[model samples]
Target: MYKLLIRPLLFLFDPEKVHHFTFSFLKITLRVPFISTIVSRLYQVKDKKLERNLFGLTFKNPVGLAAGFDKNAVLYNDLADFGFGFIEIGTVTPKAQAGNPKKRLFRLPKDKGIINRMGFNNKGVEAAIKQLKNNKKKVLIGGNIGKNTQTTPENYTSDYTTCFKALHPYVDYFVLNVSCPNVSSHAKLEDAAYLKELITEVQKINNQQNIQKPILLKIAPDLNTIQLDEIIDLVNQTKIEGVIASNTSVNREGLKTSTEKLDQIGNGGLSGQPIKEKSTQVIRYLAEKSNKSFPIIGVGGIHSAEDALEKLEAGADLVQIYTGFIYEGAGLVKQINKAILKA
Candidate 1:
């Protein structure tokens, strides 16, 4: 129904606008009494066998909604009804910003992929925390936090520290998001030394709190094997909880989308089918390098049960979906969860 009926209608509008409209509609629909129950009945796949614990949090399943979807905390309850094991919200910054200009999100339908330079446009950490404070659901929520674009790398630790403190009370885990390709200076923070400083600072603050939430680093899919090895070592040295194998790739190699059309869409992270193999490769590398000691949350190009299975087999403790949710709709969660159970 979504691919045939709802998606075509939604795709008719500008991608970003449609995203807002769809979430707004969901927010309204989910507010109605008993609507959540009905939605869950239609979408959720219940199985006690699917429950798994990761980073000290109990997830109903291993599939979660990746960050960048609910950048702010809005619509988490609505999304929770759709059967996701958990939801990671935000790439939120210290302050609210409009992000990049219009037409930043582009759909590459031919490639079953998307190119986005949304620049972490979010309502900021405070606003997200306000929404989260009111949230009543038990579903695990991970906060994917990033620095403001204007913040220089010299003071980057402060930006991550501020966001980490603000969201500490609300989230089940933390994903340091220094790898987004959209923001101009954001990718530069992915340097191993800088990342270690940022993660260490956040860990210091988390330790002071009564409850310490597990913190994981989110990395780009574009890194090479040596760089990945450094990251694995860094994870071991930092004692961070885990790694989100990928954020999104800047690579557009081998995309089915034409050179002319892709060139026209230029400069953003490429996600979906084009990223699946590389993401899995990163997972495999991280898994082997860590000797399977560090848990991995795999995210990139998961559009089917097979894709999810490949990541799991390659060594992912859990998997997340972003572009796949766009292409496969709500059923993707149930499908992946079922496949995991079968395995």
Candidate 2:
């Protein structure tokens, strides 16, 4: 029904506008009594076998809604009815800022993909805390944090640490979102030495707290074996909790989207079906190189149950979906869980 009727209608509007409209629609519709209950019954798949214990937390299922979908943490409870085991909120920063200019988001319907350069346009960590204070504890939540857009190079660490400290009490886990292509100073965030420093500092703050939250590094799929080797070493050296296998790809190779249209859309991180293989390959390489020493939350381009299984087979402890959720609708989450149980 969603793919045939709802999605087509939603697709007629601007992609970003549709996102906001959908969020508003869900927020309004889910609040009606019995609606959430019915939605839950239809979409949620619950089984002991579906539960995933990773990084000292148990996810109801291995499937999660990736960050940028619920950027402000507003729709988590409403979205939870759709059967995701967890929801990652925000590529949030210390301060609120409008992301890139207009048309920073684009859809590749033919390719089942999306391209976005939305440079962390969030309502900052404070607003997120207020929304989180309303947490019904309906689903596990991960905080994906990043540096502010105009933040100077010297204060980059400060921006992240500030958000980490502020959001620590609210989120179940932390994702140092370093690989987003929309953000500034992309190279510095990926630098092995700098990552070690950042993780160590965040770990320091975590230890100071009564209960430390798990910290995971989010990386890009575009990294080669050598860069991935650095990632393995970084994880080993820093002793951070885990890693989210990928963020989004800057690569435009083999896209079905026309070159002329892509040129008009301009540069941004590409995601969805186009990067599925690339993400799986990255997960396999990291898991292989690390000797399966740390947990991995695989994400990027998962559009079906087979895609989720491929990542799990390649050594992902869990999986996340963003573009897939947009393209396939809420049913996809339940589909992946059933497939997991069947497999």
Candidate 3:
């Protein structure tokens, strides 16, 4: 029904606008008494056999909504109705800022992908906390945090630290997002020394907190083997919780989308089907290198049951989706869960 009726209508508008409209509609519909229960029964696949315990947290299943989808931490409970075992919110910063200029988000429907230069456009950590605090669902929530774009690389630690501290009580886990290609200076912080320092600072804060939440690093799929090795070694040394293998990639190679059209879209991380292999490769690399010592949350290009299963087979302790959800709709979650159970 979504693909035949709903998606075609939604596709008529700008991708980002349609996204907001869809969420707003769902939020409104979900408010009606018993609607949430109906939606949950339709979408939420409950299979105890698919349950997973990762990073000291018990997940109802391994499938999760990747960070970018609910940047401000809105719609978590509503989204959980779609059968995701967890929902990661944000790439949220310390301060609220409008992301990139208009058209920062684009759709490549033919390629089953999305290109977004939405430079951490979010309502900031404070607003996210308020929304999260009201969440009624039990699904695990991972907070994906990043520095404000205006903040310099030198002061990056404070930005991450501020967000980490503020969102500590609300989130079940943390994803340090130093690899958002859409932001200008943000990706520069991915250097090993800077990452080490940033993680160290956040870890210090985590230790001081009453409850220590797991911290995971979200990295770009574009890193070289040496960079991957450094990250592996860093994870071992820092004692951080885990890693979300492969954020959206800056690389646009082999895309079926024409260069002229893509250039028109300009710069942003390319996600969806184009990223699956690269993301899985990173997951495999990290898993192989770490010998599964560190948990890996596989993300990027997961649109089907096979994709989700492949990631699990490749070494992901769990998996996440963004473009996959856009292309395949809510049913994707239940499909993945069913696949996990079958596997």
Q: Highest lDDT: which candidate? A: 2
User: Which model scores highest in TM-score?
Assistant: 2
Sort the candidates on TM-score, descending order. Answer: 2, 3, 1
**What's each prediction's TM-score?**
0.98, 0.99, 0.98
Candidate 2, poorest ten consecutive residues by summed lDDT: 46-55
- TM-score computed on alpha carbons, candidate 2: 0.99
- Cα displacement (angstroms), candidate 3, residue 16, comes to 1.2
**In candidate 1, which residue pairs get closer than 3 Å at backbone N, Cα or C atoms, i.e. clash?**
none
Off by over 4 Å in 2: none
Tens-place lDDT digits, model 2, residues 94-143: 98999999989999999999999998999999999999999999999999
Query: Any residue pairs clashing in model 2, and if so which?
Result: none
Write candidate 3's Cα lDDT for 1-343 as tens digits.
8889988888889998898988899889998999989988998888788889887899998899999889998899888888888999998899999988888889998899999998899998899998998978668899999888788767888999999999999899999988888776755678898789889999999999888999999999999999999999999999999999889888989989999999899988899999999999999999998899999999999989999988999999999998988888889989888877777
Candidate 3 wrong stretches, greater than 4 Å: none
lDDT of 2: 0.93
All predictions: root-mean-square deviation over Cα? 1.1, 0.7, 1.0
Error of 3 at 316 (Å): 0.1
**Cα deviation in Å at residue 255, candidate 3?**
1.2
Better lDDT candidate (2, 3): 2
